[model samples]
Target: MSSRERVLAAVAGVAGIAAAATLATPGAAASGRYQHWDDTAYRGQIEVVRSADGPSDPTVLNGTVFVDRDRDSRHDRNERGLAGVEVSNGREVATTDSRGRYRLPVYDNMTVFVTQPAGYQVPVDEFNVAQFHYNHLPAGSPDLRYGGIAPTGPIPDAVNFPLVESRLTDDRRLSCIIAGDLQTYDLDEVEYARKGAIADLARRNDYQGCGSLFVGDVVGDDLSLYDEVKGLTAQTNGPARFLPGNHDLDFDATTAEHSFDTFRAQLAPAYFSYDVGNAHIIALNTVRYPCTPELDNADGLRPECDDPVNRPRYNGAIDATQLEWLRRDLAKVDRDKLIVIAGHIGLLNWADEGSAIHQVDQVREVYSLLHGRKAVALAGHSHSIENLRTGDSMQGWRDLFGVQSLPFPHLTVGAIAGDWYSGQVTEAGYPTALQRDGGRPGVLTLDLHDSSFQERFTVTGESDRVQTQLGLNSPTYREWYVARSAWNRNPVGAAPELGDPLVVDQADLAGGTWLTTNVFMGATGSTVTVRLDDGRPRAAVRTQAMQGEDQLVGPEWSDPVAVAEQLVHGGSVADRTMHLWRFALPADLSPGTHRAHVTATDIHGRRFTDSLTFRVVASR
Candidate 1:
C-alpha cells in the first residue's frame, strides 16, 4: 500500500467525500498572502454605483478596496470586514458597508467579481494566493471560446476595485499548466506525484484553457505540504500557478528579503508578466538569498563572497532588478511577437554538464536582449528531457549574444518530476521508468500560430503520444560495456549489438550519451541515422564535440524518434505525463524482429520515414 499508504488513502478519501465546508479556515489560512502583498496592506474605500435602472445615475465608483475575508483572490491582514460582500460590474450588484465598504457600478470592459462564501476562504499570493479580475477594456473581446472581456465600448462612472475574495481570473486566456518539479518531500513522494503526474492532470480536457504551472520545488523541504500542495492544485484541470525553487526557498527565511516571504505571501508574481495569445508570459525570481551582516554564518562570521545564504547555491543567475525588468519587458514586445521565457534555471544546456553556473550567466547578454525575433525559453532545473535545437549549442544566449542560431525557436521544458517522482509502480496507476533524457512524466504544449511557434511533448497517461527524441549508448558500447556495467549494476544492461537483422558493422559510433530530437517549424537536413534490417554494413560513427554526464549533443539529441512523433502529434500529452525512450540493443545482435528507421529532412530537403519493431530475444 505504501506511497505513503496511497497518499494517506487519498487524503482520507478527500476528507471523507469532500466539502468540510470547503476547507480553509485558520483566519483564511492567514489571508493566503496575496503573492506577497505590500502595496501597503491596503486601506478600504469602494463605490462604483450606477444601477438606478441603467443609463447612468447612482454614479460613485472611487477605488482601493480589498478584504476578501478568505475568499482567496488575495488581500490579507486576517481578511476581515466582509460586512455585506457582493460585488460585480459585468452589469451591476453591490453591498459591503459598515467599514467592509462597497458601491460597484462601472464598465470599460468590466469584471469585478466576488461570489465566494461557503465556510469562507479567499486570499492568496505568496503562492497560495488567488483573486484577480479587473481587466477594464478599451477595445478588445470577440475571439470567443474563453477569451472574453476585450471590447471597449461604455459603462464607466467610477471604476474602483480592491477585492480579497477570489476564485482567480483576469479576463481569461489562462490555462497556464507548465509543471516542472513536484519534488515531493515524502508521503511516498506525494503518491509518486499523485499516481504519476497528478493523475494525468486529473483526467484532462486540454488544460481547459489556462490553469497549471507548478514550475518549482512545491514541497521537498516540507513547508507542511502547503496544504498538500493546495490539495494538488485542487485536482487540476485548471487554475494553479506557482514559482520558487532552490527547493521552494525559506531556509527559515529571517532575511534575504525573507526568501520569498513565505512565497511572496502565497504566489502571484515575484517577478510577473502575463498576456497569453499573441504570447508574452514572463515569470522570474531566480533565487536570490542576499543575507548581509557580513553574510551571517549565524555570527561565526567569514562568509560573504556574494552571500546566497552562505552558499550551497544552485546555478543560473538573473537579478539586476530582473535584468532591468527584462530590459523594459523586451521594450514592450513586438519584435514581430512571440516571447515565452519561463524559469527555474536553464538558458541553454547539455543538461548543465558544462555548468557555467548551471547555465544563464550573461546568456549572450540575454540573447542580445532577444533581438533575433521569435522566442521560447522554459526551464525546470534539469529533472531531464532537453529538446535543444538551433545550431545545437555554443551554450545559449543565442551563442553568447552575437546572435545567429535561433532563426526562430528554443526550448528545455521537461519534468513533472519525471525523475524525482522516480520509478516502480505499474498496474497503470502509473510511475515506471522515467530517468528523463529518455522522457516520460510530461507537459509542454506551445502553439502560438501567427509569428510562428510549435512545441509538443505531452505524456502522462499517454494522451496520444508526443515525444521528440532520446536513444543512448555508443562509444563502441562505452568501451565494450564499462566492465559489464560495473558487474551488472545495469548501465542499461551493457548494450552493443549490430548483427543479424541488426547489422551496422562499421560506423563505429564512438563513446555516446546524448541523442535527442523534435523538429517541426520547417525542419532541416534531418537525416537521423541508424537503420538495420540485415544486409550487413553499418557506418556513421564520428567523435569529438558532444561531451558527458550521459552524452547526446543538443536539439534534444537531434532526433529521438523525431521528438517522440512531435509530442504525439501535438496534443501536448492530451493531459500530462507518460513518454518513453530507451535504446540499448548492441550486445552483438543476433535475435529476431528488428526494424527501427526514423528519418526527416525538410526546409525543402523533404524526406520522411518512421518505423519501430523490436524483439531481441535469445538470452539465458
Candidate 2:
C-alpha cells in the first residue's frame, strides 16, 4: 500500500484498540492512568509524509513516537508508548498509530513540530530554548530582516523522529559563527552596526547553512533592543544563537540567579555545550547577578564595591552546578578532538586592569581538564586582540593556583564592533581602525584539519592573512610618533652636542608620556635596546613586565607642535610615549652622517633589527 494509506490503516487499528482499552479500564482511566505500550505495539506500520516538491503536496513518512511516561524530555527507561499522540504541521495533524508511530506531511519552510502535550516537553537547542522554526525553504524567502520559513519544496519520505520526555541531546557537527559584544544601546548605533556588520553578513553565503552565534553583550542597558538585535540577525542567511554578557543581564532581575531570566526566556541556553566537526564548543555564562550579596566576587569587587548605581557585579566563575556539569562534559569528550571553550570574559585582556576577576580564576583547573591535548579558549568582553601561547607547562598557574599554562592556546577574539565602533569612518562606511594594534574590525575564521587548526583574521573587505604579529617601522611609525608628541607633556629644547641626539632633561614620564614612534615589544628573554651611531648604547629600562597583559612605556614630548612639524619635515625629536623613543641627531657629526640601529628579539629567539642613517650638517 502507499505510505499514506498504510499510515491510515495503522492509525485505524490503534484507535480501535485504544477504544477497547478505554472501556476495559474505565475506573482506572479516572486517574488518567493507562497501560503504556512498548515499541512492539506499532513496529514498522506507522509512517511520516515527505515531499520533494513543496509543502503544497507532502507525502507520508513512517516513523515511531513513544509515550514519555516519566514526563522527561528524553526517552528513558520505563517510559512506555504514548499511542495516539497528535503531531502536526499547521495544515495537517496525525495521531500515533498502534506502535506509537505517526505519519504526517512535511514540507520545507514548514514546521513539522509535535504539539507538546500537557506533561511533555519538546527539544531545545544549546541555549536551552525550545526548538521551533518559522519554516524551511531550502531556496530561502523574502527580504524580511527576521526572515521566516522559506518557500522550499517538500523533503524526502520516512522523515520520522522519536520524541522522549527528557532533555534531548543534539550532537551534530555544527558550523556556527561567533560575534562578540554587539552592545548597541541606541537605535542609531544599532543601525550603524547593522549597516556595517549585519549588512555584510546578510549578503554572504559562507555561513548560510550553519547558524551564527553571538558571544555576549547583545545589547547595552536598554534590554529593549533584544528584538532589534534579533531582527538584525534574522537578516543573516542562517539561524542565530546568542550568549549573555554582563550588559545583557537584567539589572532589574529580582534575584541574583534570575538576572538572565528574561534573556533565558527570550534566547534559550545560557550555558551549554555542543559538538560540531570534531570539536566540542562550550559557551559559558560568567556574569553573575544581585549586586547586594555579590556572586562570588569573581571580579574582585567586594560586597560594598563602589558603583554609582549600585548595580550587581560580575566575574568569571561557574557556579557549583555548572562547574560539575563542565567536569562531566569534558570527561565525556575525546582527548584527541579539539575542545573550544567560549565565554564573554576573556582569560586575559588588555582593556581591563591586570588580572581582573572576569578572567578565569580557576584557569588551571580548566586547563588541567584539557591537558595534553589541542584546545582553544575564546572570550570577548575586552574589545582587543590578544593571543597567549602558553607553552606546554601550565606554569603560569603556579602563582595563581599552583597551575601553569597548558600546551594548548588561549585567544581573545576581537569584537565585531572593534573599539566600540571607535575611530573615523572609512570609505566602506564603517570604522576602519578600531583595534589597539591598528587591526581593522572583522571576524576570526578557524580552519580545522585533522588534529591541527589554522586561524586567520579576515579584515572586512580584505583577503585572509594568517599572520598575527604586526610589524611597524616605516612612515606609519613616524605618524604615530608625531601624534604621541602632540599629546605629550614635554617639548623639545635647543639643539644638542656633536655626537648627541635630542635628549629630554628628566621629566615626569609617568602618565601621558610619549617616547619614540618605534615600539618593539618582546616576550620574556626578548630585548629591545637602542644604540647611538657613536657606539654608545642607551640603556633600556624595564618599564613594565606584564606577564599577564601587554603594555608599552617610555618618554614624551612636551611640545606637540614642534614634534608634528619635525614629523612633517622628516626631522628628529626627543620624546617617548608608552614604549617608543625619539631622538634628533646633532648638526656637526663630521658633516657626513651616522647610523643608529634598533634590534629586537622575540621570545622564540628570532631577531629583527632596523637601522636609519642621517646626514650631519656642518655647524655654519
Cα RMSD (Å) per model? 21.5, 21.5
Expressed as tens digits, the lDDT of each residue in 85-184 for candidate 1 is 4444434445566555566655443445443232222333333234433444456543332233335344444343345322223312223467877777
Identify the runs in model 1 with alpha carbons over 4 angstroms from their true place.
Answer: 1-62, 70-130, 142-196, 200-234, 237-239, 242-400, 403-437, 443-620
Please write out the lDDT profile of model 2 over residues 318-422, one tens digit for every residue: 565556656766665678777778888864443343443556655656766676767887777776544445542222343444444435565566667765665
**lDDT accuracy of residue 306 in candidate 2:** 34
Global lDDT of each model?
A: 0.46, 0.47
TM-score of each: 0.32, 0.54
Measured by TM-score, how close is model 1 to the native structure?
A: 0.32
Clashes of each: 98, 65
Give candidate 2 misplaced runs (Cα > 4 Å). Answer: 1-176, 208-210, 291-311, 350-353, 392-403, 466-550, 553-620
Candidate maximizing TM-score: 2
